[model samples]
Target: GDPRLQHISQSIRVVPHFPKNGIMFQDITTLLLDHKAFKDTVDIFVDRYRDMHISVVAGIEARGFVFGSSVALGIGAKFVPLRKPRKLPGEVIYEKYSLEYGTDCLEMHVGAVQTGERAIVIDDLVATGGTLSAGIRLLERAGAEVVECACVIGVPEVKGRCKLLGKPLYVLVEPRQVDQCF
Candidate 1:
């Protein structure tokens, strides 16, 4: 693992039972608060991708935007947002996927990614990998070659990477559960 990733991992706040019970949510809001960690997190990604000759950076809605946009800017590529249903205000295409409990969907605007363009998907975390899978499908449907999927953190126990259909995944950290004090 990258040594800088250790610093990145240490900054994350793990909240037990977030939005539900028996779930250890790796919260990145704390990482965002530390200036050096935040910059390092983005820098690590930018450095890896800067020489890849990527054409587009497609970010999963919400958290992905935080890193993907900056990465795109760094690499001089266009930023594409894969959003939740009805969030994009244009002629959009969508892909529906299964979640652990129910179903969710991701949308991308038409023409956002040109056919045969080299693209990468970005998200903050990968839990079940369903979300990243959907993003990959959407890009493929748009005729883009998804170079890879990148996230800040990964939950190893769940094996989220298994659901990615063989697309390479890059994660900065795999956080271990720390006992909750509060």
Candidate 2:
């Protein structure tokens, strides 16, 4: 199915110097504030995977939670959180990856995804694809098959590093300048 990038593009706000210097954060908070926009973002994912058998929806830390949970609810699938280091309460499988600012780690609950479960990883954006790669590794370690990845936005320049080639990628929008705010 063809994804609609226009609506998602219109809803995002480019914020400069967020979290630190030289980083242009793609703020989806503005999109979340609008009901229609928020629903559209979720709908895009739901439509894309309507025919696929998705048992769980895994969202990356922080921002990914906002959209991932909504998509999970919309599609009637379980929601799993791929969180920051030491965030998960119980036993977790961890993976470390580099971020735009510095190095960081992501973790998932020990039993978040059962063996052979079909899962989809969701995030707000994919820049360097570091976070997404970490999430994929963690899920695979837990014995889940990652069917696809969904993001609100994709920065192709960063993805060109060859981190996201074999995965089926779906994005609501792809901005020309992912680091413009920096």
Candidate 3:
């Protein structure tokens, strides 16, 4: 077994037909339950960005919060959340994007990131990449320089990385992308 991925991969529960038919969900809840696996996952990111001088850690809503906040704390950067519409209290900026199923939007506080600040967008995985792309767009509109995007897993067959349009992608585990499977 590959020591680097053995524990982490094992911790991820592959649930078939989740949320819909013919979907294989890479559930990280099981990974979260394994303290060592979870810490190792974050450590992989922390060690990579600790010295990169990233000014802001922009995490996508929900799952992104878990790893993004931890990485922010480790790197001494502020954690900015890209949330669903109306989830933020103050004035916010939003971006509309297309998901595999339908279109949705992401919102961030007006001043979450300062002009020219370096930011890294975080999400658990990159399947279709629309959501991450939207977050990057929103940050750029706010005048932030998005340094890159980070995820634990990458679904490359979906060509999600291509949607970034030239931004660097940092990921730990890259399973073969199944085009038709969710």
TM-score of candidate 1 against the unseen true structure = 0.92
How does each model score on lDDT? 0.86, 0.80, 0.84
Tell me the deviation in Å of residue 66 in model 3.
0.4
Candidate closer to the true structure by TM-score (higher is better), 1 or 3? 1
Tens digits of per-residue lDDT for model 2 on 4-100?
A: 4566676787766776777666778878887888888888788777668898999998999998998888888899999998877899889999865
TM-score of each: 0.92, 0.87, 0.90
Which pairs of residues collide in model 1? none
lDDT computed for candidate 2? 0.80
Better of 1 and 3 by lDDT: 1
Report the number of clashing residue pairs per model.
Answer: 0, 0, 0
Give the least accurate 10-residue stretch of model 2, judged by summed lDDT.
Answer: 156-165
Q: Model 2: how far is 3 from its true place, Å? A: 9.3
* Sort order, lDDT high to low: 1, 3, 2
**Candidate 1 global CA lDDT score:** 0.86
Error of 1 at 148 (Å): 0.5
| Best prediction by lDDT | 1
Arranged by TM-score, best first: 1, 3, 2
Model 3: residue 29 alpha-carbon error in angstroms: 0.4
